[model samples]
Target: MTTDRQISDQRVALVTGGTSGIGLAIAQRLRDDGLRVAVLDLDREEARAVANDAAFLFVGADLSRRADCRAAVDAVTGAFGRLDVLVNNAGFQHIDPIVDFPEDTWDAMLHVMLTAPFLLSKYAWAHLAASGQGRIVNVASIHAQVASPFKSAYISAKHGLIGLTRTQALEGADAGLTANAICPAYVRTPLVTRQIADQARTRGISEADVEQQVMLEPAAIKRLLDPVDVAALASYVVSPAAWGMTGAVLDLDLGWTAR
Candidate 1:
């Protein structure tokens, strides 16, 4: 348990899309690490649920909207008084071939996955820098490095996210802040669960086949990654131990990238 003194001394973290799955896990991990935690999600009812059940503050916002992104950051800083760690983990996936992918869906994906991170980082920059030990951790995908079929919008947005992460790291180098991205493969979260179902439908395969042939085909490790596994990496990225690492991409892809 973090004491009041520890909470006061530790940095506050605001996690976007944090009401459930990987984002929620990351929020819990950081909260357990003694930081004051706030979660931003689009669902107001879900936000209330997280606040009540997890004891973390929750703010409602749609990451696809720039105004909502800015409002989320303002709400967190207002509630916590300072924002020091940012984990840009809000994302959704729409699996469709380039020829059939919807234009609006593509726009939404880019806005949420790429633009929202940039806007959040921009809004949070001054407070993070003022903290004198700011850390930004972006939860990118293995797709960030390697492309996959039928995920045009998702792949493009993730690749762009890594670019944004690098830019943030370079710009913050002299400002007592660091930025990095974590690229993971097939984590067991709602997003991946949805992807599994989508892949099954798209490829005319069973969900089990989606897991075995589609999701695990690239990774040496056959099992899906647990949420805590990714959360542990996020925790490390924002911790003092990672102070020297910036503009780096930490791969937790079960050796998928090594190939």
Candidate 2:
């Protein structure tokens, strides 16, 4: 158990899928913010190679597995003595029409993107509440608010994530925990880069046309956002100043929803 004085002196954070892209950025940002950061990813060796920082703790786990999720929370708290922030940022995209979508793929996507977060939160609840300023930041997408074709699984999972975030917020209010979701437009990550080819194939268009015509068409800004753009927002969401910002679905959508 962590003492109140220890909690106030040093906070710890765990970021899922923290080896690359948005998760890596958020992990780095939290580490820089003076928090002891732990990264949970599927590939332990890959994560160890990417997060080569002495200060950052790296734990590998397949979030799609319930056992892994429980063990992951245990690993973090066991190593750091407490968990103050949880960033559910691990996700992937599969672009295919519903008729052609693989049932297994849908299950796998939901397992990683939606169910994993719930399991992590359930296992980490006590440790988080103990910190007395726990924060849960879900890296949802603009798809949570509106949908795009050929991304049924991703959009559905994101929509469900928001619901989970809200429920967590309500339950954690008295425990001094806050849950919020960050809904951003398309971001420049390996996940989005991979989608270029997938989108081109699904839409029967040139790969060059995917970014402008498919990805950025809905956003008024018409550009992919950097991972750091999200990291900055997440940094704020987990900060001491954001205590009152619970159950908020924050849109860093580049005006995608403005219209």
Candidate 3:
């Protein structure tokens, strides 16, 4: 029931940090949507351990390294022969007061959260352009639009990512490629679970209080976000119906930004 043209028109998606958590959820969702999914992460074994068998490829590459970013893109295009969607979802967070924030930590956060997306976008541009329906979705944070104490580097890098997303949108418009960002708040992921503990210790609060009084304090909804929720949103955003929705910064913040 398929022709060669239809086969060549098949969509392929590459998700960074796709080994687990939000990244994995997105990859699985895209795969279920009938797209060839490629997961780029740091460890091949870890990637395989959590990767869906339906996924098209698992590439081991550190996003924080520019060479690795290029290589990951190359590997995906090599394996799939084309790239249609890019989910820039690889990231980690470090929480610390500005005065105590380590310079190296800041640099590392920027490298992974901000610079990596740019590098990946750069390398994937040509292939994405050729797809005629290329989609670039950056997983930014609520901090991209707001400030929180003890998260100087995280907030800064997220803000920069938003800027990059907007610029990509402008540049990719002529090429049928679209760029957008999803800004989530307090998602229940390994990175956020670790932050819950770190923030508790730093603020001298119980972990429960940290989640209640601090993490969900600004939101209308008081619960942490589910990875599947974000993944669902990602699916919609990258679909053909969302072609008109480029350059938008969508908030999955449980009304945190509404306040």
Alpha-carbon RMSD to native, per candidate: 1.8, 3.0, 2.0
Q: Give me the displacement of residue 222 in model 3, in angstroms.
A: 1.1
lDDT of 1 by residue, 221-248 (tens): 8989999999999998899888899999
Each model's lDDT comes to: 0.90, 0.91, 0.89
Q: Estimate each model's TM-score.
A: 0.94, 0.92, 0.93
lDDT per residue (tens digit) for residues 1-259 in model 3: 8887776778999999887889989998998888888988887765776664644588888877778998999998988799999999988877678999999999888999999999999999999899889999999988999998888988999999999999999999998899999998888988788888987998999988999998899999989998999999999999999988889999999999896
Q: Candidate 3, residue 138: CA error in Å?
A: 0.4
Candidate 2 residue runs with Cα over 4 Å from true position: 1-8, 53-55, 197-209
Which number leads on lDDT? 2
Q: What overall lDDT, based on C-alpha atoms, would model 1 receive against the true structure? A: 0.90
Best by TM-score: 1
Ranking by TM-score: 1, 3, 2
Cα deviation at 113, candidate 3, in Å, is 0.9
C-alpha lDDT (0 to 100) for residue 184 of candidate 1 = 88
Error of 1 at 104 (Å): 1.0
Worst 10 residues of 3 by lDDT: 47-56
Query: For candidate 2, lDDT tens digit of each residue in 1-259?
Result: 8776865578899999898999999998998888988998876676788867645788888887889999999988898788999999998888789999999999999999999999999999998899889999999999999988899999999999999999999999999999999999988898788878876988999977898887788789978899999999999999999999999999999899999
